[model samples]
Target: MEPNGMKCAWFQFLIGFEIMSLGAYFPMKVYVYTHDFEEGGKENPKKIHFARIPVIGECIVLSNNPNWYKVVLVLHTPYMAADADAEVWCVKITGSAARKAAGYSAS
Candidate 1:
C-alpha cells in the first residue's frame, strides 16, 4: 500500500511537469509606477499599487493629443484577440522626470 501511494504521487508529479512543459500555464506580468520629481527622485516616493491582468504583450503608449501628456499602458493576451479581452492602465504624471520616463511630451 505504501509503495502504491508513492507511485501515485510520482505519477501526479510527472503529469504536472508535462503540462507545465507544454506551456499550459501562463504567468501574469508585473509593472511598476513611481513619481520621479519627488524628494527622492526614484527612491523618494514609493511605488503605488497597480492592477494585474493577463498578458502576452505589454507596452506604454503616448497620448496622441498634443495638449495632454499622458501614458496609456495596454496589457493584453494575443491568444484572446478573438475574444477581444484587453485591459488598460491609466497613470497620471505630475513631474517632468516621470513624464519623460513615461514618454509623455507636450509636443
Candidate 2:
C-alpha cells in the first residue's frame, strides 16, 4: 500500500535507517532583518525569531539597526523517526554580542 506518495515497504526501510542513524549533527546559523522602520531617526526594532517546522526549519532575522547581520541558529534532532508518521520540530537561537551588551545595559 502507498500513502502520501510513500510506499509502505519504503516507509519501513526508511524508518529503520532513521532509527539506526539517529544521531546529533552539526548545527547551522543564519541572520535576518526587516526593512520596516519605527518613528524618529532610529529604525524600528525587528522581531527576531526562529522555528523548526514539520519538515522544513526556518530562521527569521530582524533588527532595527541599519546594518543587518545574519544570526545563525544551530540545532540537532537525535533519533528522528522516519516512519513518515513521525512529527518533530526544533530550533536554536544565537544572539549577537551587541544585542547582549545592550540587553545588559537595559537590565
Candidate 3:
C-alpha cells in the first residue's frame, strides 16, 4: 500500500472507523467518500458498490501523538459529491484537547 493508504488504514484501526476512499493527492486537502459504513457501524458493501460521495479537508499534523489526528473537513451541500456549498467540520481524535468535540462520528 502507499504511505497515505497505510496511514489511512492505521487511522481506521486506531479509531475503529472506516477510512473512506479518497480522491487524488492534493496539497493540504484529502478527499473522502462518506457512506462506506452503515448506521450500525457495519461495512456497507452496497454503498461501496454504488456511487461515491466525496468530501475534502485538511488533516492537522499530530507530531505529539502518532496514533491520532485532527481533520477539518469541508463538506458539500446535500452531502453528496460536488454539491459546491461548503461547511467546515472540526474533528478531534485521541490527542486533541477538544476531544472529538463534534457530536457526530465519522459518517
Candidate 4:
C-alpha cells in the first residue's frame, strides 16, 4: 500500500476505535457544593430515616428537584436513624429526567 493510503486507513481506524471506547468511559468531574445547603430532614437537627433506601444501580433524586441521579453506593447504618448523619451516593444525570421505570411520577 502507498504511504498516504496507509496513513488514511490508520486514521479512520483510530476514529472508529475512539467512538466505540466512549461508551465504556465515565465523564471526569470534581464536585463542590454551594454554601446554600438544606438540612437533611424535617425535624430538629435533621435526625432522619429513609422509608425506602436506594440500592446500587438505582436512580434517585434529591428532595423535590427535577434532577436525576444513578445510585452508585449506599452505606446504611440501620442504627443511625436517630443520629445526625446519613450517607448516599449517585452520579448526576445531565439533560435527562428520571425514567418512569425508576418510580418517578409526573405529579
Residue 95's lDDT in candidate 1: 51
Q: Order of all candidates by lDDT, from best down to worst?
A: 4, 1, 3, 2
lDDT of 4 by residue, 68-89 (tens): 6666665554453333223555
lDDT of each: 0.43, 0.36, 0.37, 0.50
Worst 10 residues of 1 by lDDT: 43-52
- Listed per candidate, the RMSD to the true structure in angstroms reads 13.3, 14.4, 17.3, 14.1
Sorted by TM-score (best first), the order is: 4, 1, 2, 3
Q: Residue by residue across 1-107, what tens digits does model 1's lDDT show?
A: 57888999999999989876653344333233322343354422222223334222233333353322133455454574333234344344445645665588834
Displacement of the residue 59 alpha carbon in candidate 3, Å: 9.9
Off by over 4 Å in 3: 1-67, 77-96, 100-107
Residue 1 lDDT, candidate 4, scale 0-100: 53
Off by over 4 Å in 4: 1-49, 80-86, 95-107
Residues 39-64, model 3: lDDT tens digits: 44332111121123333333343235
Model 2 C-alpha lDDT per residue in residues 1-107, reported as the tens digit of each score: 45765677788899988765543232122222222233233323322223322223333333453443322333233444422222222222334534564465422
Q: Model 4, residue 24: what's the lDDT?
A: 53
Model 3 — TM-score against the truth? 0.17
The deviation in Å at residue 87 for candidate 2 is 26
Score candidate 1 by TM-score against the native: 0.26
Where does candidate 2 clash, by residue pair?
29-72, 29-73, 30-71, 30-72, 31-70, 31-71, 32-61, 33-61, 38-44
Name the candidate, 3 or 4, with the larger lDDT value.
4
| TM-score winner between candidates 1 and 3 | 1
- TM-score for candidate 2, please give it: 0.20
Pairs of residues at least 3 apart in sequence or in different chains that clash in candidate 4: none
